[model samples]
Target: MEQNKEMTAQESLQLISESFNKSRKDILRGSAKYFMLWGALLTVTSLAIYLLWHFTGKPQWNFLWFAMPAIGYPLAALMGKYDEALPQNEVSKMLTGVWRVFGAFAITLSAIAVFLVPMHVTLIIVIIMGLAECMSGVLLKNWPIIIGGFLLGVGGAVFAMLVKNDAQLLIFTLGGVLLLITGLVMKLQYK
Candidate 1:
């Protein structure tokens, strides 16, 4: 007990420095899987959008898909993983809020698709999903979110290709509306 009390300030500082350095390294090492996961999601979305749009006979915005997921899964999964590696108490909680919002949006989108109830409103929802994905990427400092956004944009355009000119207008309109809603909702919960 006496020896513990006699510990020097310099020694404590050194210990802290060492611990901080170790944590920093740990964060970097653990981030890879998350980044890759994000990247893969972006890449898949990009490809899906490209196919859908191209199949619909619209070649105008399809080119964006090629650049969609340059990062891929491993890089994407590592995104917040880096933060997790740090001595993050506050930041982690905040980031998880974003993740939670994202998860909600995901569920909503999945429900929409699974129900097979396509509507003008549904198109709007899809757009919202796209924007949510993009925002998530930005918040997390993940490139995959940007890629996801681009893919969503492409996907929206692709939807236009599937229908006639008159119907295209409706789909595009709702898609934009829903995207706006999605973005807003996601932004509200943004940490």
Candidate 2:
């Protein structure tokens, strides 16, 4: 028991130390894709909001953000098709756990809102953001993706109360801001 505890402590200390004292290659390689992703995400999402808001005027169907995957992701996949991804199965498994719990809870909340809220906004955004969360969960192995799922569910419920078009627009705009803010926070923390 003493040996096990000692080794565990040593492992924990090593992890903490390595995080702060990473190599230049480690730091750059670590943040390169992550920062680029955030840069692309925010840029594309902002553009999508602009285009969707301008063309459709149907902010409810904010489906154009998927275009990022169509353009940006495909390009990256093409670029990295030859390279190998890092071997981090354990972290990925842990991340999947977080995403699963959050996903289930968020979906449950959205389901409840659908039955009780008497509005569709909550349901719609939940579906959209829910898909995003799932993709992040499955692809990126980032646990923070769960927050987006939670926001989508909760934001939808809050949006239900807004009855007028102007008010609805405000609510949706705020929802977009909320997503952007959450993404920025994750970028700052994780980067």
Candidate 3:
């Protein structure tokens, strides 16, 4: 009877662990898509901004960043539709809250950057993104995201200090590449 009780307990623990893992993976996979989308958008925009400024000497072209919202909003909404359609358990609900807070913080930081130091906005944004990624990684117990986030934060700071003028292009490009790589790693490893 004691042995049967022990076996049952072990089985319950195993099942709990498996459920937790599945929930975590589902959340991470959803997040990976966002990371990849943003990564590609940033990469392309950075290259375009660099080329436009380098060739045409038009500083106003920086306004191209405004397009991000136009593109990102729809994509995010579409993604959210799928997520909302799925039934969320308590763990998933908590994970969703975590990401919601992260998004709010990022948007607030961007708003602040727009007013304070517009010139350094790209680097600042990259650093913020890195921190958010690090937080997500820690929460999910995903090493690739943590490492990528650390690299992006450090790289953005270094680029800011060294590049001086027209640094956004480089910083954004590096951030994009890091995010893309991390997303891809998470997708492959988790799935």
- Please, what is the TM-score per model? 0.41, 0.40, 0.75
Cα-based RMSD of candidate 1: 10.6
Worst 10-residue lDDT window for candidate 1 reads 182-191
Name model 1 segments beyond 4 Å from true: 1-7, 56-90, 113-191
- Note the residue pairs that clash in candidate 2: 122-156
**How large is the C-alpha RMSD of every model relative to the true structure?**
10.6, 9.2, 4.8
TM-score of the candidate numbered 2? 0.40
Candidate 3 clash total?
0
In candidate 2, position 104 carries an lDDT of 58
On TM-score, the candidate that comes out on top is 3
lDDT of 3 at 153: 80
lDDT of each: 0.49, 0.50, 0.71
- Tens-place lDDT digits, model 3, residues 28-94: 6666776787778878887888888878888677667667666877987888887645455554465
Error of 2 at 177 (Å): 5.4
Residue-level error in angstroms, candidate 1, position 88: 7.5
Off by over 4 Å in 2: 1-66, 75-85, 93-122, 127-152, 160-191
Candidate 1 backbone overlaps, count:
22
| Top-scoring candidate (lDDT) | 3
Using lDDT, rank the candidates from best to worst: 3, 2, 1
